[model samples]
Target: MPRRSGGLRSGTHYKLRIKSRDKGAHNIAKQLQDFKKEDIVMIRTIANCHSGMPNSRFLGKQGKIVGKKGRCYAVSVLDGSKAKIVVAHPVHLQKLGGLAVQISKTNEGVV
Candidate 1:
């Protein structure tokens, strides 16, 4: 037997399937959503679209938008003790709240 090796979405058949209730035409609003630098966003993979899709490991992880590359946005996420950047489309990202407050609070006690 041989071990398998591949990038992010190597074995995500069931993990990224769309539910019945969510089955329908894609939302134009979501496809056209815009994100600014420093915005906190949660990665939500769109199963059908693979262009600019981040790794499945990063799915549901919150990251800060750093900049834009072509039509995709560069996002910085903390993976374990290291920081990593991934390029993803807006359709796979959902805005999240309270990140600024949380960051500030975490920094307050640090000398």
Candidate 2:
């Protein structure tokens, strides 16, 4: 037997599964959502759609939008002390509110 190499979705069944009640049709608004540069957004991987999907580690993490690459957007997220950029489709991203203010405040030593 040999050790298995963990991939992008190595251990994320529960985290990405959609509830039966919530599983019907994909929302058009979500699929066509638009984001602007510098916008704070959360990485939410689509369960079935793997196109332009980011790494599983970035799931549920918040990041700032850098730019748009075709139908996908470039998001910059801080993993520990390093800043990494991830390209993901709009369906895999959700706009987050208010958390940006708190993050800036903490960085400025105001909180």
Instruction: State each model's CA lDDT, in order.
Output: 0.81, 0.83
Expressed as tens digits, the lDDT of each residue in 47-101 for candidate 2 is 8776888888898888788899999999988787778899999999998878674
- Could you give candidate 1's per-residue lDDT for residues 7-88 as a string of tens digits? 6668888879999887878788988999888787888998877778888988888777889999899988878757789899
Measured with C-alpha atoms, the lDDT of residue 108 in candidate 2 is: 39
Please state the error at residue 2 of candidate 1 in Å.
5.6
**Scored by Cα lDDT, where does model 2 land?**
0.83
Q: How accurate is candidate 1 locally (lDDT)?
A: 0.81
- Top-lDDT structure, candidate number: 2
- Report RMSD (Å) for each prediction in the order shown: 3.2, 3.0
* Best prediction by TM-score: 2
Q: Candidate 2 at 42: error in angstroms?
A: 0.6
